[model samples]
Target: MVTAKVETAGPLILVVGDVMIDRYIFGDTTRISPEAPVPVVRAGAEEIRAGGAANVAANVAALGVACRLLTICGDDGAAVELNGLMARQGVTLDCVTDKGQRTTEKIRLISGVQQIARIDHDCTVTDAARATLAARFEALLDGVGAVIFSDYAKGVLTALPELLAIAAQRGVATFVDPKPVDPARYRGAFLLKPNMAEFQALFGSCPPDRIVDRARSALDEMGLDHMLITRGAKGILLVSRDGEVVDRPTQALEVFDVTGAGDTIIAALVVGLVQGLSMATAIDQANIAASIAVSRRGTYVVTRGDLDERLYRREHFMTKLVPLAMLCDRIARARETGARVVFTNGCFDVLHAGHVRLLAEAKRQGDILIVGLNSDASVRRLKGAPRPVNALADRAEVISGLAAVDHVVVFEDDTPLALIQALRPDVLVKGGDYTPDSIVGADVVRQSGGRVMTVPLLPGRSTTATLGALGR
Candidate 1:
């Protein structure tokens, strides 16, 4: 429960657990093998990548955060490849090489978007090796912002309690990507991220309705701060100790290979937490990152540039039309981040430069801008017949596509008074034509102790003028 924020130059993260090498042989499967009852995958290209905990570290480093990976591996050629991959990703490794142990490696034969077969090589460490790893882990925890345990049922994290104690002593956050063996060993962790199957396996199966209650009970029993249940297609569900349950739905993606999606989640989530982002915002970022990871083949690492482009596409353009209930839910989450909300409403039948200027100026007044769009029926009633050149859906889409607009809520009322009363935004903005007292929702905003302001509209730029010129 460390509330004080710890700032660092690199937002340094330390990952300790199992390390492995993932090799992929890609080609076409055209014929069946006569020798065996299987399709022959004619290998065309070969690729190597860091897997397991090492993949997590690669993701963290790729996102612009300096990462240090600590793990136990054997002195084999596979170990050399894993080390080389980690080094190329700019990850500093503190590896404990054991000559007697076997280096973990997984080779997959992929043919036309399908994994034909996989071969795995893994080994466990001896008691003496585990002791040596613990010593190295203790030395690496100094000045670290966060620690991630990427357990793969390997012996690297046998001393979980001691690891948690050391991280707690230093006031550093600790997160776990838990293995299926023993859930009790993960107690006292700041956050536990277990996928759906793993979560159900650790805790007995419960009905969907009772998941939150059962999860709360487990959190209290384990003394954990939070548990993030990652559902593959359903997205992530975060349950906090204070009985807060937040659900972030997955973004639409054409998933090619689901391998390493969990690793991307852990890397992006920990970075967001250490960077002081609210849980909601951090989860949003992680969801976006995971969406990108699943679209690629094999174990892929998501970079900061990829996230930046995705976020820009999400926020800057695209009409974000949401129902009233969903809008209120989003507003509540935004409020938790101490963001000031600015509300504005208009028909915006045909977009023009004046409307763009007004919306952009309104955005400058607050952290988030919510535009209340008048429905087609409401517009026809207010402006009479032959009005509303466009439908509600089209207008809402156009308004939402702007970079300045964060949310668009279509209302059927002539005035936005009822909607304003419900939202109670921090600031109510209007175009320059209206004075503060003349605004429709000014009184409702004032009664709520909110401010009312007007942004100057661009001269000689109006949708009405454009329509009039067309008639002339």
Candidate 2:
């Protein structure tokens, strides 16, 4: 449903909550240690990433939205590393440094794909630091379109009620990834995102069928506008104050790790809302983003390009037969992400081994391979009457099913000059018989700084030869 690239010029998103560092020490375990009876890991790599609320902000920025994070941090080395990570992600940091506390950090020892142990250096904010954070929140609320509260119950969100009131007064929408503290503190927020377990912990347990009713009741009781309950493996459920409920199944095919998936959902949801999408549409996009997050290990940031590709695939899932206009739009979006587009046009009246080889080779030349099929009328004009062994629809469908073909567009012209001019693909490909200068539209492609090349045809395979053998 998201047809175009998200406009990044809209509003600023303010993320305020607990921030921490997630450090992973990856190694291979050979045998048990004599002293501790634990596997001795031979260290291979060490990686650090933003965690908690900082992760939420990173995901927001990764979507090309303007974001600023307001959190409390200690004046320690971890704080410095956290700042650097946020800066690299283009997240503006408005952190309150507390000299008396140590910055929170979670160090995980990973053996292969398994986590061996986790060590936590936890820190809580002081009243003085909370006051400072509140002041900073108010100062940054002027241009904020949405506020995200990523609470980890790390003592930073103790003043959530006051912060919610301030954002409410400014008429800015607030979203909360709530901790199981006091539900009343999240009142007046626009939406609250809680996983299945957290939902039961906050509001008393209820059957799956009655979740909507309970969520509606919770929404009314908390003075919230909506609630998103994430059910792992089951899907996401959206309950609004006006008795509208929408449930979307999880999009993940294989979930490698679910770390920071909730953050990805909230971040993408807010971004979608800021882009003027409906609540249901935003939730759908959020579901897609969560699927991408869980496919990777540890915390992951889903970018705009990643979402675009997933949406494109979903749209063309059944078949890659697309109209020229739609294909042009898709090409534009792909080009923005630095993807190379390869194009070749032919009748493809009879699918054969030679055609398959050519398509496969074309895909190897670029990231996306677009096949231009000549319409029946165009084939009649170019190859004479009764030349095509198949209709336009049949040929297009067969070509779209090939693994190397990313998209199939039917062009009416005898030559694909018009499509080539419109699409302006990065690479223009043809069969072996044609030279670079002899290929139709090669000049136009070359004028646009595109490459023109040809692939060698299979010696003994051809549609003409097959038709002759069939005595058609």
What TM-score would every model get versus the actual structure? 0.68, 0.74
- RMSD in order of candidates: 14.4, 6.0
lDDT of 1 by residue, 1-472 (tens): 7531446555789999988899999999989989989999888989899999999999999888889998989888988888899989999998988878888899999888889899998876877877888888888877788999998986778888888888888788889998855877888899999998888888878988888888898899998999999998999999999877989889745788889999999999998877788887888989999998999888989887667656755764445766676677667756875889999999999899899989999999899899999888899998888989998767877887788998888899889988888898999999989999999888888888899998887898887898999899
| Cα lDDT, all candidates | 0.86, 0.89
Q: State which candidate has the highest TM-score.
A: 2
lDDT of 1 at 116: 88
Task: Estimate the TM-score for candidate 1.
Answer: 0.68
